[model samples]
Target: MSESTPSFVSLLWGTLFLRPYVFIFLAAYLCLATRHLGLGPTLLYLLLGYGIAWTSEFCSIHTGIPYGLYMYIPATHSQELWVLGVPLMDSLSYVFLSYASYSLALFLLAPLPRSPVSGHPVNTGRYNLATLLLAVVLFVTLDIIIDPLALRGYRWFLGQIYGYPEAGIYFGIPLSNFVGWFVVGLVMVAVLQRLSHWSVPFPWLSWGQSRSTNDGYLGAGLYLGILLFNLILTFYIGETLLGLVGLFIYLPFTTLAILVRCHPGFKAN
Candidate 1:
């Protein structure tokens, strides 16, 4: 085999072994998305999401358009995978993150059935402009907690994978980064909405048969899982102030989500 072949294999396996958390979340996303959106749509979202995310990162490093200029450190290139200097896992993360955000938005915006016989109150994953925009907002909100702590990755197990040439205001992250996330979320959800209309039938790939009443909550739970993971890490690394800020930012939204679940008015048909 060629020398580059081994390196590529190593990077692919290393990315999964080194960053097990990303795959764990990805697994959750696959299950949740396939159940609600069908395997065909989920796979399409995964492929398209990765493409958009990788292209965005590739462009940002070179041209500083959407996310401004930020460079991957490539410190772990030999140990993990680096696709053109961007960590493979980094762009791959956008797939699950955007899906989780979109799932949660659907849970909140769609009308819930009052009957207990049906699955969880989250109606069929529907999309409107309001839902799409809310998903974008949620996608950006996740980064509000994630990016700051990630900047301090050197202090934790994440290692120092990337950095910005210039310092930023919010926990050393730039406003442009969030703006880029917003744009990505918007684009992703909009595309997903369009894809939902396509007739790409994959009946054999369907995994929704084992559906549970609790399935509706899984997507939102995945969102919370990621949010709490970052928040706990923020505190673990002794960033008490930053952790508190994240909590404060999420408190009202969490409250609203809870109300959406429990409120009788929201259970309207």
Candidate 2:
């Protein structure tokens, strides 16, 4: 078959696969995740909670490194191309972590309540700006860890845009590989923030909520899983444990730092 051949069935499947249904599913999940925590705004967190993760997945596809593993998995007469070892699900973590960070930041800052763009009638002056910003930051941070790992052979690069056929390293990271991640991450975040303006019901969800145990735990779990999964892959499949350990250390510290900054008056010391 020619590459130009377009199958109606395939198109249909793809459309269904990329439909808005998952966003709805994500919103539902957010409610559950934040129900116990007393966080600021559950609904606002939903958009970044899902959109950022989606953005990360999209980033990995184009860059072919960072947040994904190059495993030769068994496919239908082919190998499964995954970004990290965890498949597409890893992208979803971008959303959860971004949301977690946004919520944590808000909780600590005690910012005014904003409303979702959808005009969901937020009680305070809520805005989705924080969520959007944090989403971008988290994605970039993931890449920072990934670029060096790929150069060190902890993660495999599917395509050689630069470097010495995967044997060379610049500052412990392949120049081409790092460039790819930075460019992709920057562009993706810009696009997603615009998309959120249109699709999100309330902008405040991005910046309107408080920190809660729920957000913290969910963020911790999502990141912890990513860290462990990468470590396991490092031992059995590759050598990306450095990135995993970095994440294990960085994520908790970030959450703690935000907490400390927000509630400076309270001191156990």
Candidate 3:
């Protein structure tokens, strides 16, 4: 074996041990963003996430998958604060995720429900406060659906604190994790929306060159693609049918929720 092979294996082993949840988060991000962002951006995000995940291997913070399957071993403090356990790549994942979700919302779910909560009919425009709030809410809801399953095993990095196996159960999820997912997620989205100049009109995919592309096809494709790919990847990597079942159960309800939320006056008797 080459000199680097052992270290690489060790790093992978440590990541699995220390930050197991990274895999689930990474996988989920890949699946969602791939379907939504497609080609160039999708590949870019994947490489970015991989690099971040790789760097996190040296940090003081630990993350793992499957509760205990993998772990992140921290390098000595002399390596510099960011390099120790925080891996540059892992930090980068947040940027990618925040941008991906924000763009996806604008493209697929934004101009949201003419007032998602109070149901006040309003005009659709660019980046209004209300629009931003709705975007955050949508991202949080997606995180909520994901955390219960994600935190059960893979969740949180070492020293960071949130959703550990020992303490078990924080607001119906491992305690540390629920807070992390919600708080971090909210903050990330806020930063990306407020500070960044990276906005683009969607139907990021080329075929989406018309009104139907934005209005229906791209969104439909995202949902379907997520549903299919998640099922397959979850089964293959995790080797369990439960992931497939969860995806099947979620797609319909999620679709219904999206439809109801989008169509303001469509209340059923």
Candidate 4:
């Protein structure tokens, strides 16, 4: 409305799209996800993920039922965009995190049967109970590293943007926060499954399909990419012990996901 007021496009770009790693992850997800779902569905995916993350944060901040009593602490001199006291970039990051986790679950649990109609080893059962459950677990495992490092944002460049009134058990993070992540992560994957029509079979890969199956290589890469970024930050902030813990927690699982994905004999279907 005002001449100096930034447009929505500029705000989104400046607040989220311009960030170095966030921008890279967002771009990597779009490129990787589109290979399977195409551009249209990918757009829907982004919308669904953003909606679930923002809504959950809004609810938890107000009610304290899920994520506990945490409040936004806007960093001094920071011009980042906030939606109802929640960082826009924070919500946007969930889109990639959820997608990568969901994809990894499918890679590990979902069987890719060679469709009778199409010879490609495609998956149409991503919404099955097994896949959903595994995705939820992976998402939480990620937060184990995320919450601690994020809490130290002030010591690094992320700044002090949020705080929990009550101290938590794990590095000052509440148990309810992880529980909330599981709930929110479930909703994110579940919504994408229903909207994307998970039962609809699509082109997967050839018998000699590249080792990098959508669920296997690219998905796992994104998951690791996010983890490594946080771990680097942890060390940068002088939390060597925390950084090692993060590496210990994430490296083995990431290695296994890639191994399971790349194995030609791994798919039951």
CA lDDT of each prediction against the hidden true structure: 0.83, 0.42, 0.44, 0.75
Ranking by lDDT: 1, 4, 3, 2
Lowest summed lDDT window (length 10), candidate 3 = 208-217
- Candidate 1's clash total is 0
Ranking by TM-score: 1, 4, 3, 2
Model 3 clash tally? 37
RMSD to true structure for each model, in Å? 3.1, 9.8, 9.9, 5.1
Q: Pick the candidate with the highest lDDT.
A: 1
Single out the weakest 10-residue window by summed lDDT for candidate 2.
72-81
- Candidate 3 local accuracy as lDDT? 0.44
Root mean square deviation (Cα) for candidate 1: 3.1
Candidate 2 Cα errors over 4 Å, as ranges = 1-134, 146-164, 168-172, 191-221, 231-252, 255-269
Kindly list the per-residue Cα lDDT of model 1 for residues 163-268, writing each as its tens digit: 8999899989999999988888899878877764556566665545345534544688899899999999999999999999999999878887878768857546
Candidate with more favorable, higher lDDT: 1 or 2: 1
Considering summed lDDT, which 10 consecutive residues are worst modelled in model 1? 207-216
| Residue 19 lDDT (model 2) | 31
Please report the TM-score between candidate 1 and the true structure: 0.90
State the lDDT of candidate 2 residue by residue for 1-269, as single tens digits. Answer: 65564465654454335433324334534653444222334443444544554554455445555433223221211122233333343345444444433333334333323345543323221135554455445545555554444344423322221233233344445445445444444454444334323443454434533333223334434443444444454444444456455557467646655666566544233
